[model samples]
Target chain A: MRQANLEEETAVLGFLEAMEKGLSMKVLSGGALGVVERDGIQFAVLTSQALLSLPQDLLAGAEAAGLPLGVLEGDGFHLDLQGAALVAVHTKAQTCRVTEQAAKLFLYGRNVLGDSVVWHEPGLKRGDACIVCNGRGESLGLGVVVGPFKGMREAVKPVQDLGTYLRDQDE
Target chain B: MTEPDFPVARFAAGPKIREWSRKHGFSDWMVARILQLTDRPADVLEGLLHRPPRYLRANPLRASVEEVLSRLEAKNFSLARNELDPNILKLRQAPISPGATIEHMQGLTTPQDLASASAPLALGAQPGDIVADLAAAPGVKTLHVAGDLAGGGLRERGAIIAVEPDADRMRALRFNLERCGATSVVMRNHTAQELPGKAWADRVLLDAPCTGEGTIPKDKNRRHGKPEEVTAMAALQRELVDAADRILKPGGTLVYATCTFAPEENEAQVSRLVGKGYRVEPLGFDRVASVPLVPGVTQWPGLELDPSVARARHFLPGVHPTLGFFVAKLTKRERAI
Candidate 1:
């Protein structure tokens, strides 16, 4: 639990900016950026620690209304379900909609097959972290793209999915 | 001639009450109280004897309602849309425990009954309002407030300061909030009575601890309660309500609720607040319109309360499928009496 460093912050901002050209670090509004490193993963979190205890006027307000952002993993940022929602709310994050079968499989933590892809937004290249949506355009989680789009083999490796929260929760 | 006296109401006490209580596997006090709570005592008692159906509230932040419902249907789950409460999905059947499903893991849906779900709606925290759940533990309602309602006010995320006194329950609270990916929730571990700071939150929710009489269908032990026990619980609830009023910003809304039907903890508590000049407000929502709820119990033989306490609503166990829950909303005064 520490404030994110300039280097770590820049890396995350760069990754998000590269993935979605319109998205900026402005989404982290009203929340302080912090890092919680566990199991060799530095998880980036947006929190209201700075403002929660103090009195807040309704007028002097800047709200970072939804979720704390990215889960910075091994090397690059692998935005988890919470993080994916953070970036996608206003402008869509780099995303791909998958079939119902693929969505179910993806939720089970499996890599999605190329055939499972219903459609994907352009500008996302191989190894880029992308938001995975079900056929109804509901996000399953973040996945790392592995080209080519039209193939019979694995196209995206799931780095984090929604089920991760259920599995990782404390009893 | 003997069966004609089966009019349970005509012979309310002694043998009649005892026989009804024994027949329903409830204590005499519980049976007698239920009889007084409603004219349809048989229906209420019968409702407590059986298992109730489960319902789910899909987190829109995670998935679209259409997608989540369609996906679950594919998994052999028989679900029906609850026409009464459009936001809830009634689980007709499930192949596995709904809690163990992948959709639950994805933070997509939660097993929230209609009554418990109504508290946050009653508070009506705007998207960016600073909301405090005074007794937040195993944070089911906190998750709803922060995720689905104004707490998630997705653009300018409002904040939730969740306070749970017990460490073990706080762990469970933390788990539910994380499981739902509910954002900007600040969790504190301590009793609300001694919680530091004041007048910080724009809205406060004290879903206080109660006798849990409404849970008889799920856990039968709650069907028996002593009057002294309710009085003891009321003392603690009053303390928590005081804490809620202390921290809530002037002009903020405070929703004090419980999952029980006890007047000692329900109307009596609200009547105390109104005695202190707290302006009681209606739980302004159409969601509760279809719930078979009656006005808050204003009088309980020798214990008459302020008529304003009637603004509180009780979702009766017999009349409503959900727990016999009680909810009251009030607007804080600029200066306390």
Candidate 2:
């Protein structure tokens, strides 16, 4: 729950910067925000999550390694649906806006075929991270680019989607 | 998968008992217990085998009650407003699972049971209070508390310290909070026993883990637990409540809730707190109570509990339309100087 050190700060921004050029601290910085780890996954948390209700002693203390509210959260960066949504709005990241039919398929844990991708970022290439969106430009999930954005082959591999919660319930 | 062998040897399986148990898919012991607890055993038995009416609550962080209602209505889904909470809508009928709908994907709404949705609000979390949610996993109640603290995610400056010890459930909790945009929470992975003590929280909510007998309708496996499992769970619940008491500020509200009808887990646990002189308070939710609630039981066979347990309410499935749940509210006693 401590403030994100310079190294952690740089690493988070660096991961995002690759997707959207010039994505720096100015665009990413919200007051009193920092990265914290839980179960080996990284999250950017608001200061409230860091501040314990009681003061902590070195020997015994309670702290929040959790985030306050959303904080444009990430869990493993690429596989985080919330983080992808945050990235889509805040930065001009690589995105593929899918058609209604394709959005339904993707939500069912299917990869995005070229025919279903109505529009995609012109700069997308193989192995790049992409945010999958619906007709309203709302994020559906995060994906990994499989081929050229305009190519007819399967283009984005679905890594995470909003339907995950539902699928988990089914099990 | 094949069904697990249901334990059925405890009760005397009379002809009538055998017929009723076979009809309701309950073991002889469960049928005998139900008959003991309710005059309308048929109603209770039927409730255990079928799902209750589906319900969903509008997420203020993503959409308004009016907006959610309008959208769902446009989808031709019949809906009704829950008598307890207006923002919660009961699904009369739907073309698909509510979870697959666009509204859910947009975080505009969350599908939760009417009873489960009401548990956290019992704490009455306000804008500035520092609330603690012990055993908060899968984030349903945590999301509600966070929204209340944020005044529906519109403003900030409230905090919820949510603790869950399970790793897999913890992941689901984080994802749920992020999806709903409820930002006033601080997640902690520590067990209830591990929380540091300063009696600092303004309110504490311990939705203690229980046998989940209340969820029998949707999950059949709940009916198959061994008799001793309830006792073992009650032991764990006691440990959890002890931690909740430790972190609660003097005079702070402590809400203890469970989803089982076991007297040991319900009345016995709360009665222990009352014995410590924690004053029992009315839940104050009587007016909006969606279903009839009986007073907490004072005696379970051989055990005669204090009358103070009556301050709590029980939401029995046959008696109430929802699950068989119990909720008790208490105010921590001030320390003597």
Candidate 3:
């Protein structure tokens, strides 16, 4: 969870730096602090909702524009910038399953251009769900990218008894 | 709007907010109360409350800041330094029992209000001089200046007199002083004005008690209080600053700081000091200008002070990403023999 927030913060800082340089872009997906774009570079902001929710086309376009992309892998994620890039992902948790489509696009783009990319993977754990796919089915295999939206959120015990929740599997 | 009776419940309902509240070790109810008072977007509040607490660099004269932080981080705790006080830190990872920590118990680290740290940092204490931390309960800035003076060998001639009005807090100050290994400090427990040793020092730090309007982040009750209550505190602040001028030696520096946003307590108090023939010194606004100096109060609405009143420093968390505070630096001109 913390790693997700940091990525969001770094992305926002980059976006603001870009904006200060006179780039005009509207936030396409996510809330107030989401990524904005000028010509085609997709950038993220600290307060915006996660980029995983972005439309597939925009995410791919952002990748092509030389825009830095933060890909959520297992528990943590990877941050790709122009000259200098470092990855900060959770090492404790297992990698989340990424959609085959996202996996191909993310890896291919990096491999083809192959700029200097610094990978930081931290605090990864197993059994984490993909932020985009939400673990309904295996849309994406585990450990494709790095960042949050893959960490575990255990169910909190009930503070108040709203009666008992009947299990679907139980008779 | 009147405060809700059930603040704790409100805080626990939201996952992000609850996480932050827990991280800071704030009571479930206190967390809820703070969130209710803010006009900020939900995410911002989460960031402010749950994001890592800022770390404070302890003045070596006061305590072992680096060592303390390392130990705490080992316990899964994190903190951030206050933007204003190089010595004051906000805890990001709430300690199960922060006060009981060896460093805290040893007075090596103090859990101070972020706004409280701003006042002294704005004062900008220098080496080779006498300094006073008036209203120096819990001695956060006193320790800050001590740490700065460490290894400089400036204290051979200079002394730091940390004066607290309350007896309990004065003891707290002493404990911190001992833990930080600051030996050159003198602890006095008396209302600043009533203390017999007036103007005996070269520099004075008055961290006056105010209505604490700016302390809502730490003390949520401040928001629900009446404005007149604050006004009353402002009146008292003026009296304290007036007394501060009397105690500071001519050519000595005096820093007036408060954790409240009330102009009456901030700019107005500084204006009163400037009127006393103290040459107002400008406090630095850039990031590198660390140390506890007051950022003068010159530009807020309803202030009738001089246009050149740059001696005061005003800090609002909303503006500076920290707590709300006001500070001003003034140098008492040398009196003719």
What would the per-residue lDDT of candidate 1 be over residues B99-159, giving only the tens digit for each residue?
7776787677888887888788788767767788899887878877776443334332667
> What digit string (tens of lDDT, one per residue) describes model 2 on residues B240-310?
88888889989899999988777777888788888877888888776334445667888666455679888
lDDT of 3 by residue, B203-305 (tens): 7888888776556655655545554555567766766776778778888878787776555566666666667777777765543224333334454545566
| lDDT string, candidate 3, A1-171, tens digits | 111355655454454344233221222112233333434433332222222332232233221111123343333333322111111111212223333333333322221011211211233323322221111221111233322333332211111110111111112
Candidates in order, TM-scores: namely 0.76, 0.81, 0.51
What shift in Å separates residue B96 of candidate 1 from its native position after superposition? 5.7
Question: Mind sharing the TM-score for model 1?
Answer: 0.76
Could you tell me which 10 consecutive residues in candidate 1 chain A have the lowest summed lDDT? A57-66
Q: What's the CA RMSD for each of the models? A: 7.4, 5.7, 23.8
lDDT value, residue A50 of candidate 3: 25
Worst 10 residues of 2 chain B by lDDT: B1-10
Fraction of true contacts kept, per model? 0.29, 0.24, 0.00
Off by over 4 Å in 2: A6-31, A39-41, A46-80, A87-96, A109-130, A143-160, A164-171, B1-19, B22-40, B224-226, B287-290
Off by over 4 Å in 1: A1-8, A18-43, A47-66, A71-78, A84-160, A168-171, B1-13, B62-85, B92-103, B147-153, B179-181, B224-228, B285-292, B301-304
Give the Cα error of residue B328 in candidate 1, in Å.
1.0
Task: List each candidate's DockQ score.
Answer: 0.21, 0.24, 0.01
